[model samples]
Target: MTETTIRKPIRKAVFPVAGLGTRFLPATKAIPKEMLPIIDRPLIQYAVDEAREAGIEQLIFVTGRGKTAIVEHFDTAFELEATMSSRGKDLSILAPTRIQPGNLVTVRQQVPMGLGHAIWCARAIVGNEPFAIFLPDELMIGSPGCMKQMVEAYNEVGGNLISVLEVPEEEVSSYGVIKPGAKVSGSLTEVVGLVEKPKREEAPSNLIISGRYILQPEVMRTLEGQEKGAGGEIQLTDAMAKMIGNQAFHAVTFAGRRYDCGSKSGFVEATLELALERSDMAADVRAAIKRLAATFD
Candidate 1:
């Protein structure tokens, strides 16, 4: 690892979960969207597990009102556990839900300003280290997790790193597109510049920013200006763009399937796909689906 990489070992990760999740309403009206289970595990659990696998010591959650369920999700359910144990039932089911003490930290974003503002709210807790950001709505299914791959590249590049996923050229305008400058490694590239939701013809490349990001502390300082962008709100991409050319900037092209869990369709698809991979539920899920398909036939 380079000297810079050693100094900023990336011990903290910020999860931007304050969004109102209007797309998934009215289920989200009372429960947080992150608390919605993909199958058995909630969406936030997958994100936290990924961060923990990447050596992230602190999971900093940027949340809002009605999001207490998110915080409680990671806490010890003492009464429930005690009841389960008293019945002589196996307790391994609650294993993954348990979070170690001191590993989780949460801060409230009073208002829904924007992604940048929500992240900026964590500046104090994050202090001066280069922290990571993970959007729980995007479930990245990979062997080592997306953030771990980015950390490997971040260690070598020693600057800001964002995960890039190849989308159809027609979908370029849906995400922040990157202008590939040079190849850094196998799937890593030197990102000289980027454009937010550019038209197909204006897109720098087919690559679009994914949900994972390893950013320097300076990005928060840049967001302090609170300059509103496309949606009349401070966009994180705009602030991140300013960091280009200031240091080493690159994008790590992902080698995993990303399930967009923010929308109903995507969430259902993820549930079905993941359910098919389990031993206990695979047969039943597939048989039920096949029966349902026969009805259409």
Candidate 2:
């Protein structure tokens, strides 16, 4: 098995947590949707965890007005920690929430722009180096985590790479589908083209671009003068499409389950599925699920 050559170590990662998260309202009315927990940890935490696992050093959060909670989640809760310490309760539980000093960075996206604009907001912080992007709403579940797998692949290939997963043909219209070039390996495919939310028949393939991406800094230049393509928003897909031929773009077919927590159904499914996987909660969650199903019957 080949190992990561570390051509350029991925140091920074951007988390676009600026969206209003209207789908999960009024719950999200007061709280950021990224703060909504899957079981114990918030969605953004999972993304950060993945980044940390992948050896990312800097965590950049592109945030909005109401998203302060997202940043606070990673900070040290002194009062809570003191209370826990005084009570002699297990303090290690807070370990996952704690980020190392000077590692966490925040940049604001004042308007509710598209994902591309949110990402571009962090370009100054990202400098000239390559960075990873993580959409917190997409709860990717895997043993090594999604970003770790992508980092390993990125270390090997050292170009642009987006995590792709084959969704159903009927669902192709809902996602940015990739026009595949060649199957480089079982899990790697050269991305010749990208069609954002293409009609099912017009879709190049069933593979949809998932939430994770490792992009070159040149993309920032492409997005600098980029006009809105779809929905009058600066779409990342449009910028990435322009970089296809100029750069080596590929897709890493995700070998994990992705829970689209952006939608109501997906949120509930993620909560229940993750809960059931927990040893402490599984039995009770299973019984509760059976009881809930009985009401419908």
TM, every model? 0.96, 0.97
| Per-model CA lDDT versus the true structure | 0.90, 0.90
Error of 2 at 167 (Å): 1.2
Poorest 10 consecutive residues by lDDT, candidate 1: 1-10
Residue-pair clashes per candidate:
0, 0
Backbone clash pairs for candidate 2 read none
Off by over 4 Å in 2: 1-6
Compose the digit string of candidate 2's lDDT tens values, residues 123-186: 9999999999999888899978888888888877888999999989999999999999965787
Error of 2 at 55 (Å): 0.6
Instruction: Please report how far candidate 1 places residue 119 from its true position, in Å.
Output: 0.4
Candidate 1 wrong stretches, greater than 4 Å: 1-5
Report the C-alpha lDDT of model 1 over 15-49, residue by residue, as the tens digit.
98999989988989999999999888999999999
